[model samples]
Target: MTMSSGNGISFYMPRYDFTVRARWLERNARLIGVLKAAVPTQAIFSHVVVSGQTVGAVTRIRYDGPGVMVPRVFGSVFFYQPSQKINLCYGEITESATVNQFAEVIQEDLDALRDLGSKVWADTVANPVRHVVQVNIQEW
Candidate 1:
């Protein structure tokens, strides 16, 4: 968004390309316009680049289709990224029952899913360590 000052010129514009915590402005784009009308300022929200999603699951399923015997559909859990307020997050998968939400992510899978934030649950086998690291060290 570009704003023009009284002299029939545009104000300096800046492009923001990054993730920002949920903000009130996100729900009110109209406020930006109001500010433009009342004052000489412009604000722009770069296209939303959905970096990634944290959910209960990501799944691929097959279903009957018109031309094909089975069609493939990709689904994921939709939820907010790990932030200070949300200690435990749940994924509202794109559609219910499409993804496998029952499967548990064992502790060993932590490194691979580092950005998965942190899992806050009772330290039970369902989320216990399983995988082992293979290493051979030789001292000379």
Candidate 2:
């Protein structure tokens, strides 16, 4: 799946049924192989604030060489209480990369997710989002 861009960020994040079919199994294999193959290249740190107070920074994301490799499927379901409508979506149809360059990718994706959380509305379902939590990437 090709990652979508928003709030000036772009990267793949999959959720829903397809996540059950393919991506779920693939990531685990790497949990054994690639994760061990890679070593902590560096420590991760960042400072975040919501409404003008310093929250925290650099939460200890161990940059192990590169991220894992795996296939993925993703989607999001949004419920808008005001509009009385539900938005069901699936996209970015592709397997993820190996040698993920994770230190960079994680920062990018987390930002995108946070941005999305801000823009959408809440309704019956909790605006649920789930994607392949890629532990490794090969840059395929």
Candidate 3:
């Protein structure tokens, strides 16, 4: 089945192990928000960007839409705003879950997200790891 919720598209998989559930957030970034990399590798992860909206304590990013509770998220996760840089060391890193209607990220988490963004930017084309590179936000 397919459905649209919280700035993203949701494809629900009937079974957990028997199927795959996928949620794709368009460039909106608000749905999935930029998050700390959870690839089972990559040490020192952190980030959180809150778009133009300023959320004081906690901000709701993604909710019960599509892969909200599926696949499980672990380690330091980030929820960053689109078109913004990540800051991995912006704030204290932690975990949170969705409740009632949507998943919420605290301010500290947002700060951390910013730190990760900076790190990613620095480690990537911004610093030229292997070859000279340039980062264009609008183009990306």
Which structure among the candidates has the greatest lDDT?
A: 3
- lDDT tens string, model 1, 75-136? 21111122211111222213222221111223343333332322211111125653221111
**Candidate 3, RMSD to the unseen true structure:** 14.4
Off by over 4 Å in 3: 1-102, 130-140
Question: lDDT: which is higher, 1 or 2?
Answer: 2
| Pairs in steric clash, model 1 | none
Cα-based TM-score, every candidate: 0.17, 0.18, 0.24
The models' CA-based lDDT, in order, is 0.21, 0.24, 0.26
Candidate closer to the true structure by TM-score (higher is better), 2 or 3? 3
The total of clashing pairs for model 2 equals 28
The clash tally of candidate 3 reads 18
Q: Per-residue alpha-carbon lDDT of model 3 for 1-140, expressed as tens digits?
A: 22243322111111111211122324324334332111111122212333211111122222322323222132122233332221112333243432111132333344433443444435432565522122111110
TM-score between candidate 3 and the true structure: 0.24
RMSD of each: 20.2, 16.5, 14.4
